[model samples]
Target: MDRQFYIISYDIGDPKRLQRVHKFLKDYGKPVQKSVFECWLTERELESVVSWLADFIKRTEDRVRIYRLCRNCLQNVEFTGPVYFAEEPPEELIL
Candidate 1:
């Protein structure tokens, strides 16, 4: 495996707060699931991003889950460019 991306998920309490987090990660990562994001990061970058993710998650009232993956662990990763979410809700939930 050359480079790998991690799939991180968040179970948010409020639809509003969940959207906030989804936006944050989208600006920095890729949104795979509704509230789950996939990011391709180097080891150092991943670690730093995870730390930042933890801080972001802690700020939310929702339950957040992150999965940091190795090259061998990924099933399918569509390398979409960085995503930036809106302040308002998405027109449709990407489940």
Candidate 2:
């Protein structure tokens, strides 16, 4: 299976809804920023994440953006400042 990388960011209006979205994303990826996550998923997994969030968010007020990264893009990502996230994905993720 080929897994692709995605950067998911959101601006949710309600605190409760924001927390829910954060928790849901934890199951799919790692947090790279307060409102951003980096996910390595297969196509189906990506679809699942979007589908679940579609129900959790209010289209009229909240915004969610999922940015797909090609292998070349991943390799070229530049990091500066405090490093709370891994520069590269783990070789193996348990669970």
Candidate 3:
């Protein structure tokens, strides 16, 4: 699938909230690293997911973000897929 991936970072105010968001992201993808989570969606779906996340955060007192994959795509950095979160083959995977 030819789609963009996102590395969302939420500056959640509290550890419990941080954990809450992390758990929520599990519905989307896995955590390839700490704080940073990976989730793949097309141009349109991405916006929906971001909006959902923002609204979710608004229900609480925390910070959220949806940094564009295009902006964060560096030359040499590998972090994608649901390796730590999926059993079947995920459409998006990076190593």
Candidate 4:
């Protein structure tokens, strides 16, 4: 399956919900910041993430944004200070 890079960021009004969202995202991506994540996901995974967030957040209280990064965009991403971008995950890992 082909996967694309996504930058997911969120703001939650409550601490509990914020923690919940952070924990859930950890399963699917790497945290680039306190409330920002870098994920490489297929279409199915993206849909699942969106669906889960849709059901979990309060529309009036929380905000979530997912930005799809194309190959060119990913290549041109810049960073400064101590922060770095997430690397692409390897396909088919055997343990």
TM-score on alpha carbons, each prediction? 0.57, 0.84, 0.59, 0.92
| Predicted candidate 2 versus true structure: per-residue lDDT over 23-57, tens digit per residue | 99998888988999988888889999999999879
The segments of candidate 4 whose C-alpha lies over 4 angstroms from its true place after superposition are: 93-95
lDDT for predicted candidate 1 compared with the true structure: 0.62
* Residue pairs clashing, model 1: none
Better of 3 and 4 by lDDT: 4
lDDT of 4 at 45: 95
Span of ten consecutive residues with least summed lDDT in model 4: 79-88
Candidate 4 local lDDT, 1-95, one digit each (tens): 68899999999999999999999999989998999999999899999999999999999999999999998987787778785667778886668
* lDDT of each residue in 1-95, candidate 1, tens digit only: 23355667878777776777787777556676687776765566666766766776645466766666655544344447854321222234457
Candidate 2's displacement at residue 22, Å, is 0.2
Give residue 58's error in model 4 in angstroms. 0.3
Task: Tell me how far the alpha carbon of residue 92 in candidate 4 is from the true structure, in angstroms, after superposition.
Answer: 2.4
Q: Report the lDDT tens digits of candidate 3 across residue range 6-37.
A: 66777777788678888888776657677777
lDDT (C-alpha) at residue 66 in model 3? 70
On the 0 to 100 scale, the lDDT of residue 51 in model 1 is 79
Total backbone clashes of candidate 3, pairs 3 or more residues apart or in separate chains: 0
